[model samples]
Target: MGIKSFLASRKNQNKITTHMPLKVSDYMSTKLITFKTDDKIETVIDSLIKYRISGGPVVNSKHELIGIISEGDCIKQLSDSRYHNLPMTNNTVEACMIKNVETIDGNMNIFDAANKFLESKRRRFPIVENGKLVGQISQKDILKAALALKGHDWK
Candidate 1:
């Protein structure tokens, strides 16, 4: 093959391999443990500890994501004696949650998703579609994907 032809073929092959599209569904974890808006702060804290997760989507009665809660929210509650001593009946997830939830669809690229996570200061992100909670993506998940892409297993 001529040198010019070989160079052009190699460049095209590089472009094809390097620009391979990635979808969020490829990395998002579908086994999601979500919270209800009416759930108590104690319950949310319990779930976070039990699952060893930082945070997740908060859904309403119809399973539509309306907010998000995190360990940070619980910590914030502890700062007030009223919240700390209040009964579960007096406290609700919505009160302490981040109502302006930021979500990503399953079709988003992993890099773009990572950028969103960084921009949002969120460790966990709820995957959604048409206003319904579908799955979750976490910083750990993104790091795992990066490690795997580099042919290394995350320890």
Candidate 2:
């Protein structure tokens, strides 16, 4: 068969699938274990262990994203408390979480989100809408999305 005819024969035997470009919201985890500013450090630690999560977002009663608390931050708190001879249990999430939180746009492309994670060296980025905590996207989420698109002709 000629080149054009040969290519048409193969194309007729296989199906092509197209997908809308992936977005962060499509893969982000909406059900999150969030912490409050006034919550005790002990409680945060227990939750992190129970949920098998390294960190959680700190929000106000109004659910506004405020800060983020991580295992590293918790460990740092323990070290600081020991060095200062201060009691750690009495500390609050507000005392240890990372303030000036950076959130990601839910509509951002999944690949772009992956780049953002690499650039910022952040494991996860929270999504906010109308000043409320909506969801969170993680490195693992992006990896999963990439795997899901393995056979698709998309970037």
Best candidate, TM-score-wise? 2
lDDT of 1 at 34: 82
- Pull out the clashing pairs in model 1: none
Error of 2 at 79 (Å): 0.8
lDDT of 2 at 106: 98
List model 1 lDDT by residue over 107-146, tens digit each: 8888888899889877877888887788888888898778
TM value for model 1: 0.77
Candidate 1's C-alpha lDDT? Answer: 0.80
Deviating ranges (above 4 Å) for candidate 2: 1-17
Candidate 2 clash pair list: none
What is the per-residue lDDT of model 2 for residues 27-107, given as tens digits with 9 covering 90 to 100?
999999999888888898899999999999998889999999999988888899999997876588988999988999999
TM-score of each: 0.77, 0.85
